[model samples]
Target: MFLRTPPLTAALLSLALLYSASAATHAKENAIASAKESIASSEKDSTASSAKKSIASDSYTYANLHDVRVSHVYLDLTVDFANNALTGFADLTLDWQQQDADTILLDTRDLTIKQVYARRVDGQWRKVSFELAERHAVLGSKLTIKPGFQTQTLRIHYQSQPQASGLQWLTKEQTASKNQPFMFSQNQAIHARSWIPIQDSPAVRLTYSARIQTDKDVLAVMSAPTEPGTARTGDYRFTMPHAIPPYLLAIAVGDLEFKAMSAQTGVYAEPYILEAAAKEFASTQQMIDVTEPLYGDYRWGRYDLLILPPSFPFGGMENPVLSFITPTVIAGDGSLVNLIAHELAHSWSGNLVTNATWQDLWLNEGFTSYVENRIMEQVFGVDRAIMEQALSVQDLKQELQSIDADDSRLFLDLKGRDPDDAFSGVPYTKGQLFLMFLEKRFGREVFDPFVKKYFDDHSFKSITTAEFERYLAANLLDQHPGKVSSEEVNEWIHGRGLPASSPNPQSDAFLRVQQHSNAWLSGLSTLSELPTTAWTVHEWLFFLNNLPLNITPTQLQQLDQAFNLTHSSNSEIAHAWYLLALKTGYRQVLPALEQYLISIGRRKLILPLYRQLASTPEGLAFARKVYQQARPGYHPLAQGSVDEMLKAD
Candidate 1:
């Protein structure tokens, strides 16, 4: 079974405290190295030939592949969403026969497998033995039988309607077509098997073509480059020229409407959501404008977005051609559509340069997250881009808090495909943070071109962290010579937590948590109260934002009158004190609650204050209007305190 972040307040506090200490030191040391590199590079630039030779001596560039290319794959997927079950069949053709007879595992959970077949050297296919006892379906077979690395077709039948795959999700859609009932997939975690069976591991990728059959009225969607032609009897077939890993192979079907901007791309959504979907699609041009330059032109033909029901997990899955996004972002407002650009950038980071295992998942996530930052920068602005990275840094700290393991890579095995192990720190947040570190190392003058080349060379092939390091050193590392030691960077690729990685003294945030610590706090709350679980940085920010928006000025004054600071509210409050502070400005009252904010280590939330102080005339006017109309209400906090809160800032 998989374990999640610990359910302890201490662990949560520990994560934030320790993570920042390491990150800050790491950053400070990096800034120094970067400055030296800039000065050195500038001095050596005019000696072109010598500079080029010296650049060749550097060590941080990611390496190029000598072998290991996913030649082609064929996918036959069958699913019954209403029943939440799936069966899949696939055929793979590799360039060289694998000598190790490795066990290829598919990301799956709680599934019953009836059969499996693989083509053998005996000129016939046999029912190969497999294990389904754990979360993954594991298969071990030799390819020597196929000698020169011939074609191998595999057939696997499984059944399960998964809720947590992060890749495949089943939910009802409210769209225009009565015929198209919308449902989606979100296989970010290792849950691809709950819907389709293949080498569900990202380590083994294959060119995928999905044959999906949904309810007749419903339309089926996949990441493949092409669309399903007419319903063709009862089933529809969609194929792609790109090699796709199982996780990125998505399927979305629902009551859908199809509108085309041109022959190259089409939009899919509920009939009623057509206009809403359009707003998301409107940025298509902007996405192209940014991603093309970063990864060297749009290699994928066209991009489309499929909006799933509101309850879909995660923001979206980066399905190559057609991305499956949560309708939660389909709000008439455009703020949420940046997710589309994020997934779109994955066409390069995830789809093109794939990670070999979940161990190096940062190869997929970190790169994608970074590239998503690029897309946002170009499409939105530098402020939005920096803001997004800031969110990630915050999330990493929270995840560190949630994780019970001091070792972040415990779940990752030597080859990076250990499904049954627990997660280590280097996998997600830390991994991505490393990429940002790499950017600071390379700097813009040298980094941009290197990144562009990196994508261009490795697109459509699998890349490991080690391989990436080789490329970095051979290219950029030589340029920065004294930067990271090859040994140090290589150690990072295969190491546990950093040598300097350590926990910090417990933070005041927990001490400042006055919501449930009062002498009278015990009885007023429900038996089952839900504190916002700060799983990701966004959730943590939401928890912070939750404080201000829900509190009011009047309630603040009242709270001052009968102070429990910890006074708990049993009522299902629509808003909380902190949330109201966020909107109305808690400047004056912040001095009163100064100890709590400092204890929580959120003394950095001055962004809200800066916004208030720097607001343009028009913006200030809007803020004042919102402030004047703010209503007075109580949640456990007092009404008078709420009034003071609005006037404080």
Candidate 2:
């Protein structure tokens, strides 16, 4: 279940080409270790997979300078909308290594390799088979066994309209973002293959240089920053000076008009978000304030973010640069800055120190969540931070009580989980809440510095569950003597569902609310009716969220009387009341609820409710059809839990 990997050597990555003797020795050792690990692990993995569908017969590994070292890659892509096809022209460098290594395979998905352009050290032109391509292409025509050569430099041409994966033509998912042109790539889950061809795995990290050509007005950015003099003719080029997993290789293109500002730390956001994104990013500065002091200096250059359309399923994807977030957070009201901060923290925990495989995803989720709270505590105050943590734990507990509580386990998989599950209660929130518990267990002064050490040592390398646990036990043993972790938490990583340790505040609150509501609702029977002023907004919301099993018609009338204020108030609670009133067929009071929905002002909530109402047998079909027709294209939010809403009963 685990891939064997050597411990990552201390960074032999020196910015200056000139190195001290010690540093040079370190670099050489690191390179040799990387090469040996690749060769050994590949061979071992081959032996292990020999009993399965094996690719070793034709597939092999060359030295990958992408991890632990700085290597540059450049590619030009020609994408055809008509055919849904792609062609890539790449110029990449292989660091100093010389041998009879001929089979150079790139991570390609059903791409056809045409021809390769390169100069052999022998100074002779020869045709090589760039052949043996089956679902993937090796990048050369001939196996030039040139020894004493330290690096390999070559250009390759690949063509294929790969299946929609990372870089997709998502015309369908773009409508929720105000019908603006939008696209997103969650490359972290190993979907980079559906887009570009390279070593498609996360283990082999690399520095990327890309020039993406698209229609004019198609703004561009990558997980990395754009290099100067590297862009041309709508070709958005980027240079990843830092080594990053291919999963973090992201690109978002839409008719984006973003303005930029430098926070001195790094450019915070592009200007396109002024109305919506800018407002959403209002609290983003707090994320910077809380995280920087704790995690040491920022690992990557400057942090930048982009707000995607509303259909974006996750709160945001931490794509090194330009973190793509859910468009819905742009409420223009700063109520949901916690989500903004959560994704921002991933820049350090998930982006910097990556989990080699999905199994060890807590290295990504748990750490990021913990850091999010740290950031929150700094900006929002410790009390608010603690309260938020309590609420998150409460949410996690409710999730654990679901018949499909195992679904909570999907949070850390980072693979095979639903797009909607990214901001899932378990992985992001509960995970953070767990970290909060750990913080209390250790206390801040001790826990805070340990977090910095955890990330700093593991940056740029892939880690597994075992490695994390070992570090946790070892690190904590050193600091919090006698501190021990049981199998309950760590063992939870391998399976689905929580570790039995997940909180359950919802059930507790449910019991209490059920009691209060039962008593309050029954007491209303003592009176003929409730005056409009009797039902407060907070009470109404609490009642709706904690609605009892079933209320008699008399009780419903009592409630209606309670909410029959002279003026129709417009608020979330008021909307709930109106919906309940309409549902109960309180013909006399339903008009106010209808008006309440109209007045909520969130343009996005209208169509769904209309469709649901129409679906009801007693509701007008024509009205439902009209609302359904207005529901436009592929916004994920627009498609959200429609069935769930319909099945609420």
lDDT of 2 by residue, 1-649 (tens): 1112222211212211122223435345334334323432333222111122211111122223232121334566754544555567654444422244434545554456666654344433233445423442222112122222333445566665534445444452333334334455656454565555555544555665565666664566678754322332455555555667667878776655544433522222224454556654666655775677888666565556676654454556788866776544554445456666777888788877876655455568877877876787788676555555655665466557753644566324433443334444566665565565566567878887888898888766666666776787778645576543655445445556555554433333334434567666767434333232444333334456556436566776665565453133333444455455446555565444354333322322344345436556655543344334333332324334432343333
Model 2, clash count?
21
**How far off is model 2, as Cα RMSD?**
10.3
Estimate the TM-score for candidate 2. 0.66
True-vs-predicted CA distance for residue 377, candidate 2, Å: 2.3
Error of 2 at 41 (Å): 22
Worst 10 residues of 1 by lDDT: 56-65
lDDT digits (tens) for residues 232-314 of candidate 1: 23355655544456667677766666666445556777777766677656876677766766668776777777766543434
lDDT of each: 0.49, 0.52
Tell me the lDDT of model 2 at 394: 53
The numbered model that scores best in TM-score is 2
Give the poorly placed runs of model 2, Cα more than 4 Å off.
Answer: 1-72, 78-86, 92-101, 104-106, 110-119, 122-151, 160-163, 170-183, 226-233, 261-273, 401-425, 485-545, 549-632, 635-649
TM-score of each: 0.59, 0.66
